[model samples]
Target: MGRWEPDARGRLLRAALELFAEHGYEATTTAQIADRAGLTKTTLFRLFADKREIVFQGQGELLALVTRGVDEALNDASAWDRMVNGVLVLSGAHAHEHRTTGRILDPILARSPELNERAVFKRSAITSALEGSLIGHGIDRWQAGALADLGIRAYYSGYDLWVAVDDSSTLADHVLAQITVLRGAAAQALEAAAPQPHPAGVRSADG
Candidate 1:
């Protein structure tokens, strides 16, 4: 029997990232990842579906956290508020501890088209989870979808900012800054798209 190991999933993820960075993602194998993590292949398979899964682990937990954050928001919270709450909740759980992993994983994904595609799927899943939560809580589907897109965009852009810089600011702080930028951009878009009244003396060709 194998002795108990704490944080096996995290260990496996870190090991996989380290290996993929040192070697290449395509050259790496599950057996090697398990071995690097100091566990058997069976243990790795128990935790992940396959080698690709190791790269995309913790998604279930993140989706659950997003739902929890949205659900826990005040009943009267706006859609933006609910989405921000979810981003905050998810980011808080990750925080600065995941930076090293991010720094390694980013380049790995960039170099591999397969991993990049998987990342997009994971991103969509999270957005859908957030959207569903908002709609379940009485938000209109249109608004929920739009807010989910915006929120996810902010979340990822914030993560990139966090990983690229060496700063003491938390992930939540970065996410909030991105949220502010997105909100301002959205406001500007709305204003630009709104109809502008013409001067009384100005008659259009169509008129």
Candidate 2:
């Protein structure tokens, strides 16, 4: 693709965000977004299915990147390691790309329940893709589903924290850190749930 081709999509995305911020998501029309971008409605439609699609178009690419990462991981890697690797790959692919767009998009999503629902669906799609990849690598289906959920949760948490901070670490580093935190929490919960012996001198409250 030409340099200008990428610019066209960026322009439309930015224009749509601005209009949504100024008016409202429901009030902002595709024609206005195209006009703001200095492109025709036809050109806008060529790049996106609709206004919602413009906001979510990158999700498909992210899913593909994560899936490729899972597929190419070392054969001996554990399921959790493979999931983390996929998230790291996704972070690398989108680290610097979405900061500005996210600043604009987050508030818009919060304001509209429709947008929020769509965002949840997009996240679910990513988790589903990751689960499928894990299953293909020979992991049990149920365990793979749980690991995928964890990976996606870590990804979004890390992404939010990374974009909000002015840290020197890369997005992948933040993602790994989030995954570590989640793992620690899970371990602690498991430990707490394990049965423990009562002290010899201790009496039960009921006794």
lDDT of each: 0.90, 0.86
Query: TM-score for every candidate vs. truth?
Result: 0.94, 0.90
Poorly placed runs, candidate 1 (over 4 Å) = 1-4
lDDT of 2 by residue, 95-119 (tens): 5657667777888998998889899
Runs off by more than 4 Å, candidate 2: 1-6, 198-207
Error of 1 at 45 (Å): 1.3
Superposed on all Cα atoms, the candidates' RMSDs to the truth, in angstroms, are: 1.7, 3.0
Tell me how far the alpha carbon of residue 120 in candidate 2 is from the true structure, in angstroms, after superposition: 0.4
Candidate 1 C-alpha lDDT tens digits along 56-110: 9889999999999999999899888999998889888885669878988899999
Best by lDDT: 1
